[model samples]
Target chain A: MDSCQPDEKLDLAGVPCPQNSARTLIKLEGMDSGAMLEVIIDDGEPVKNVPPSVEEEGHRVVEKVRTGDRWKILIRRREE
Target chain B: MGIYLDNAATTRVDPAVASEVERVRRSAEGNASSIHQHGVNAAKHIEKARNIIAGSINAEAEEIVFTSGGTESNNTVLKGVVSLSSNEKKHIVISAIEHPSIIETARWLEEAGISVTYVSVDRDGFVSASDVEKALTAETVLVSIMHANNETGTIEPIKDIGRACTERGVLFHADACQSYTKIPLDVKEQNVDFITLNAHKIHGPKGVGALYVRKGVKIAPLLHGGEQEATLRSGTYNTEGIAGFGKAVEIAHTDDVKKMTELRDWFSKELSENIEGVLLNGPDTQRLSNIINLRIRSVDGNRLAAELDRRAISVGRGSSCSSSKSTPSHVLLALGMDSKEAEESIRISLNKWTRKKELGIVVKNMIEIVTELRMV
Candidate 1:
């Protein structure tokens, strides 16, 4: 995990579900294929909902780390 | 025919407005943005609609920017005004009982570091100008109050609040979706900077509304596109819908207000006089001509509305926006009612075409229904 550097990072700590996930997807959509993106989202709904939505869109969940009230999610954009 | 008592939720599109929509759709074949003859013809419909809406509100034609509906108009003013304000002018004031569009947008703004002050309304759902004045600070850049409460029908003191805001040098916005055609709104006389009007509420096409931004007020655009709406709201013009909206406005006469008021009062009187536990939620006076909100003792509003639906009589439990959720009405709660009382509240709105006989049938059904519901 330490060896992989993220191409993009997003802090959606205070943003609610759907919007948080939506912002993450929008950010991921702009990234180059195979590039990793880091996202910080609020716990509970955001944490539980965003990862599945991203994965369903064919992105790989590289890592998910819980950091206090938020979770840090690392995603790898799918190569189209 | 099934009765529709939920005009506050939305009204049936007027036949004239529907004809105008179809006419525009069939005749205007090009986008309003094009420079050709087709485009010119399409732009004519848009401009004519713009003039009609502007004239209806006593605003200049250049002041109206069309959008999808009331929600978008509300969003544009709240988001647009705040986004462009100086850092020192980061606060906005709104009534507590505002529509979800304003409330939700304000919440989103709060998340984005902007400060918000929600002025509470009275028991009758009227927001006092003084209370709004008390909430305003040097940092306050805008005050958004609805012209009438959609649930309770109580009209706010918009002119007083507008005057106060003018004196304070703060922008005032009124969501007049429910009151635009029913009430007389003169922008200059009211001293309001922005007023939101929608089509569906006034028997026009859905997905079309306009924001009346008083000339010289600068706000950021919510959507960035073809630089339409004088670069304030950019999108391809919705010509058919706007034309329908114009027709709706043109046909909405002041005489209809008298007819609606009479029917509303008659309905209220019949329900309250006949039903033992019927309670009028908002002020009997200064209310919107179309809306009548009530709370029946020991009754569940959701259950009542469902039963009405079952009988093909459509009514609303709360603001249709949030009624799907079981949460008690924020408007009712702000009006000092407990959750149970709020849960017991129902909103029945009449339109210009709402007949006397239909309401009589509704009253008869409600009287029987309330009695049956109370027993259980």
Candidate 2:
């Protein structure tokens, strides 16, 4: 699949870390299997932590886009 | 968390007080206004808490009127005085360095047809009694000054100012939210008619504070509802928070933060000796031991505060509650600091339990961060 549409999108640029990651995980958990969630996070710690943490929780990162100061990532929830 | 030195903004609740709050929450389930046994039991705890809080401030238990917190307590006095004053006596006298609660309330009152006189503090942040007296006029009905400033930690000369108000037949109110349990407050000896108190600043639960009104002083109620708190503040009692507040007050005075003073002096000395462009904001000897405000030349305060946060060390650049306004502190400006210096100022307040080892991290981080930022 190329440029697959996201099922949900969350903009968490100014939100702090750990909490932002937790909120992302919470959003993913409520989604159906194989659904894609798009997230926009701050450039530094949130970018470093959220994607890997999502993968650690068994999700797959399909896309990552960086534009200077912000990061946008597309994650597909793992099918059970 | 690396190091926490923001106690002036808010303190981490002591473990004992936290447990006490949980205990009251788990066991007490009665309204103090109800007529049942549970209600009576709950009321006893509230009164017991009241007695504990009043004892620390040298006020009678009956003199205490529980409000939401310091803001409400200050608002109650400022607004209540204006509403209750006669048309001919509608003037309010306050210091320039007061917290937003009193200052903003006074501003609102001015728009509502009351006169407000803002007395400026000295460069050292002390509002002298003579300045207050000069500000007083024939129509002045109330004078509200803080016991200690939140940003600069400067203690006001309330005893002299209180005397001036007393002699002039003006009711004096002190927002003692920053100094309530930390200092010896004898309302009678100080000639004060009203004083504000809060628990969270001293390691108690938040959302609970009280106003101490001299027995016969009449002020209109801000809330008009059920007959609670002697009809001065009417709301469902915050039983658990009050209980923890009582315990916090007990712990605050009995186990004094005397060591905090020594540790704070050591921290201040270390910072000034090690950091090149450091300037202490308030007087060296006349400020609160737990709070230290410093101005670092050539570094933005917000950047420094964020750098500290990235290193897991929490500190405050201004009044934590209203710093979102993103303006230089009015308190710092009142102390004669320019907007540039005021914007560059940061406040680090330590708690009673703060240790030297933790302070080591603060000093090392300050040297690194300030140096790195200046190079950039």
Provide the lowest-lDDT 10-residue window in model 2 chain B.
B32-41
Q: List each model's interface RMSD.
A: 17.5, 20.3
TM-score of candidate 1 on Cα atoms, chains taken together: 0.82
Docking quality of model 2: it rates as incorrect
lDDT of 2 at B158: 93
The residue-by-residue lDDT of candidate 2 on B1-376, one tens digit each, is: 5788889999899999999999989887987655344664466567768878888878877788888899999999998988888857589899988998988888998898888999998887899999999998999999999999898889888999999999999999999998877777999899999999999999999999999999889999999898687689989889899989999988775345588888888988898899898988988877887889999999899899999999999888888876787889988898888999998989999888899999988999999999999999
lDDT of 1 by residue, B184-297 (tens): 999989989999999999999999999999988999999998888778888988989988999999999989999999999998889889988889999989999998889999
Report the first chain's TM-score for all candidates.
Answer: 0.93, 0.92
Query: What ranges in model 1 sit over 4 Å off?
Result: A1-80
For candidate 2, report its TM-score. 0.81
* Residue pairs clashing, model 1: none
